[model samples]
Target: MISQSAGKIFLAEERGHNELNWFRSFNTFNFGSFYNEHKHPFESLYILNEDTLAGNRKISMLAENDSCIVLIPVVGAISFKDSAGNSGLLQAGQAQVLNVYAGTTLEISNPYEEESVNFLQIWIKTPDLQSTVPQLFEFDLDKNPNQLLELFSPQKKTLVKTVPQPHGVIGKFSGRSEAVYNPAQSGNALFAYVIEGNVEVQYRLMNPRDGLGLWDLEEMELEALSENAIVLILEIPVLKTV
Candidate 1:
């Protein structure tokens, strides 16, 4: 049995909120002015921000060196353009990853006329920068229900492999459905986020927007508590503190 000491739960309500006239964001870690010493980067998983943009609204962010940025649209399509001359639209069922250098300005905007768009922006620190272009992965949850669908894997040639690669998966399960996840690499950590419905991970209940981090375990079990429950799991390598 995996001990409870290997898990840490982060409640949704405890997240930092930044609201403006056209943009609203809930940060799970230190981002912008929302700094929490207790909420530091979970291993190499640096940032996880849930952002909502009003119609025709836009926001810009500067990229850090030796980092990878991943964007997942949750509600509506979002248009993005980076200073490196890359631009595209990310739909609800799609995920995009881009290895960016320092000082790259990324502009993300809601393309809808009257509807708001919600998306998740995740940042991961890499050992070194790689010369790779932006890549998009699309998956349909309805196509394969009650199973984990892999969204991103480090095995791709486009991804940097200077260090242990991170893997990402998304799953949709019905009530009473059960699933298990085993990390591809040893000594890696797992971070699970509830996207739509409630779920129980390793005996801990989690609501929508809640996140749970676990380490020092070989595998973890998950069970959906509601219909059409969606969860995002990231297998991140444990990095040593410098």
Candidate 2:
């Protein structure tokens, strides 16, 4: 049985950095400053790191073809050139997802040439996909039409679904509507993690990084105004086999 802490935050850190093996790297945890702490992973715990790179610097001989890698820019534009001679630039409003299985090399640099670039890189076990070419999908905060981003199960086209069916849904909320979530099924477990700002959720005060877990509830309410509250929501099936 998964512990109640399963939906809890095991780690949380602000923007920070350090150097390793002659390579300067940024990470969410100060522990990364020590080389030995750089390697750690669990069955469900994949790779999670927020990184920033200086101009013309190279770290981690990352291949373009690695099971599954996603790069999301939070600040400056990140310049990238892959093994297949593929090149592109990712900015704050963009995210690049690659499935590197056919052999691909990647070289990322500061897009500004003089300034640095920062982004979040998460590596999860790719679902059983026989053939998945690197796919790039640009997301603009304005594209939501209502300023909302939709992430569903990669297994399903809509509704948040994880590759492993993830057992839950995870996302952020940053608006007035609160992204009404209603699970049509029972035994669904859900929770929300505040990333930044505050929100008057269900009349309760939620500050940055604060999280609340909920289960056995079919519907929950969220509303925010005055401040753009950023929240990470996770929904899971309490009992199911995938």
Candidate 3:
């Protein structure tokens, strides 16, 4: 029998380092001062951050000209103002995608005066790094309650199908549900993060904020272990591009 720790990447609750007063971030891979050369990035997926910002406080992040960024609010709301003049408000169940070509800077702050906000910041290096055009997208996930919904993809195709390219996929799983996740290609990778509640991913249980990265598999089965359980999955290419 394969142990729960075997052939799987299990990032426990305390493995992520915390920042100072304004931001508390957990690095799925080496990020910021949390440097681990061996843990720099996974394929095309570079950064995965679980961040909490104090009310009225803000944080700034720089994106390379050709990389892509996706932000999902988990608790409270955040107001994002970027160098491209793309500013908007996003609350829980809402997501924002930024195609940061030609270099971009983003400032994110908690809009509420008394409420702190927690959100996930993910970065993926795309094949279109030389493109100078930048685009921003915002969408809500309230349409589907218990099923896995695709929030963003390279081709912007339907929920289950993604273009077989060096791309990234964002999915949200809600309620006590079960689903099979098939990668866009045979040797791709999938990284799952439990946003809220508990879930048994491929027979291993994961709690809130726990992250698991799986590869070398044909398919994955996800079962929500609790009511209203919500998880986020990121699918990416097995090879990182320029």
lDDT of 3 by residue, 104-180 (tens): 79999999887888888888876544333333444444556666665665533322333333333334555567877
Question: Model 3, which residues run further than 4 Å from truth?
Answer: 1-7, 130-143, 155-176, 185-187, 240-242
lDDT of 2 by residue, 103-214 (tens): 5566777756557766666544433433344556555543443233533223234234332322222334446646566654455565554555665444456665454556
Candidate 1, run of 10 with poorest lDDT: 154-163
Which candidate has the top score in lDDT?
1
Tell me how candidate 1 scores on lDDT. 0.87
Global fold similarity of model 2 (TM-score): 0.60
In model 3, what are the clashing residue pairs, if there are any? 65-101, 65-103
Q: In candidate 2, which residue ranges exceed 4 Å CA deviation?
A: 1-6, 14-45, 61-66, 84-86, 102-105, 142-147, 151-177, 180-195, 198-226, 231-242
Clashes of each: 0, 10, 2
In model 2, the worst 10-residue window by lDDT is: 2-11
Candidate 1, backbone clash total: 0
Q: Could you tell me which 10 consecutive residues in candidate 3 have the lowest summed lDDT?
A: 156-165
In model 2, pairs of residues that clash are 64-104, 65-100, 66-100, 152-160, 152-161, 153-160, 153-161, 168-235, 168-236, 169-235
TM-score list, all predictions: 0.94, 0.60, 0.80
Q: What local distance difference test score does each model get?
A: 0.87, 0.50, 0.70
In candidate 2, position 221 carries an lDDT of 62
